[model samples]
Target: MTNQTSEQFWEERYRNMTGQPSGRPTGKLVEFAEALPPGRALELGCSRGDDAIWLASRGWQVVGVDISATALAVAAERAKAAGVSERVRWEGHDLAQSFPEGMFELVTALYFQSPIAFPRAEVLRRAAEAVAPGGVFLLVEHSTAAPWSFKSRTPFSTVEETLASLQLDESWEPILVGAPKREARGPQGQTAEVLDNVIVLRKRPA
Candidate 1:
């Protein structure tokens, strides 16, 4: 599907949903952020802007980009509620088409899923290109197609496979890449174990 179509799909989903889809930063993102230097940050697929708001609250200038305008609105409200509205810039963007310009101190792609019809390689390449020198790129994605309510059937690649497919630049260093089990609330309000593959890469100085 084209980026425009993808954007519309997400917009409709958020518009119809009862409440905010996501409310907090993913665990992996929280850990990654704690280790990075605070500066300009960009969050791709920001959903309702939990991570972006969290980053902004920590004094990092943040730009939260999502395909859904409704989602961005909720994110903006969240920032206001959190008392950091001025620190965040919310924008509607389709990652498949183009990425925001500028070098970022940190870039986060957390649990951003796409249908089988979408092109994953191009998305990953664009994400890699958006990272600035001495910046960090953190990716946290579902590692398995477990029978969860929010699960996607699109076959997920391992961190190793993704990095190998991308042929990352020599200046980019892989800090951590592996599958980790996490506990999350299931559809029925029960606890379930989910596997997530995390990829933390840092760009070397120019």
Candidate 2:
């Protein structure tokens, strides 16, 4: 899909959301980042901002980026409710066209997927570049389709493939690389074990 089409699609999706999210950060995000020292963070496809809020609550200044303005608004409100509004900033971007400025000590993109045609690989590469030296870039992606997902038949790239696509040099060190299985709950309360491709890379100090 074109960039305009993708924006409209995400906008409509978030606009129809019935209520706020569960106010829970993705389990993988908390698992990997909970022990890290707080610093600047950038969360791509922040959805309703649970991850960003979690980071901000831990004293990390956060910038949450998403394509849907409605989603950003909802996330901003959520940050306010969590008393971390001052620590979080929200920006709307069609990442195909532009990205948030500056670098981050912790950059995360969890399940950054879309059914529409998007340059996901390119965007992810840019995300890596935005990671400051000695900082971490954590990526988690669906390795298998969820039962309730509209893109059930869509094939996902493996962790190795994704890392290769980034084309990082020796300045990047692989901290974690594997497909991990996690128990997941579907939209209708159905439960299943799902596979996720995870890669955590730390940029070597300059």
Candidate 3:
């Protein structure tokens, strides 16, 4: 895929899909959210709203964002179907160009894979800035250089390498940063080992 395609590429991916992809919230996100103070939450790259809708069901006001309008439309439909439409807001946004402005008590980006040509550091920095004080910023990204994703040409950066590139302030404390192996069901209905890098950062009160 060309670097210029960006969001349009993702939009096409969703447009062709028959329905939302089936997957539960990443383990890292569930763990972090369980320990976090509940309030307004933002979900970046929320594909079909599973995680965002789950959070809303737990009483947190949620905003789910994605680069694809098709995906957002599906997510909105899912929210309405689940009877949590009032609790979640779905927006179409391109993170590579700009991040939405607003302080949130918790912000999460799960499985946000970047293209090799894009500057991942810049995107991560912008994500960090979006967190409100005393808030938590969680990132769960695929760490495995799986053969399946290789064909797509999406760049997968290791957790350590991405963290090192960030110029985070001293107030930002690291809660967890490492690659964890988890059991996941593959496309063919077989269980497989999945490696994911998780980072949880808490912004200290200024």
Q: Largest lDDT belongs to which candidate?
A: 2
CA lDDT, every prediction?
Answer: 0.80, 0.91, 0.80
- Over the stretch 151-195, how does candidate 2's per-residue lDDT look in tens digits? 732579988899899999999999899998998887778998889
Cα lDDT of model 3 by residue, 1-206, tens digit: 66556676787777887744674666677777976657999888899888998888788889898888988888898889888899998877777786776889998888876553555568878888889988998988887755444343654678888788778879899988889997766556667687888888899987
Candidate 1, residue 55: Cα displacement in angstroms equals: 0.4
**How many clashes does each candidate structure show, in the order listed?**
0, 0, 0
User: Order of candidates by lDDT, top first?
Assistant: 2, 1, 3
Candidate 3: where is the Cα deviation over 4 Å? 150-155
Q: Number of the top candidate by TM-score?
A: 2
In candidate 1, stretches whose alpha carbon ends up further than 4 angstroms from where it belongs are 1-4, 150-153
Residue 99 lDDT in candidate 2: 98
- Candidate 3, residue 183: Cα displacement in angstroms equals 2.2
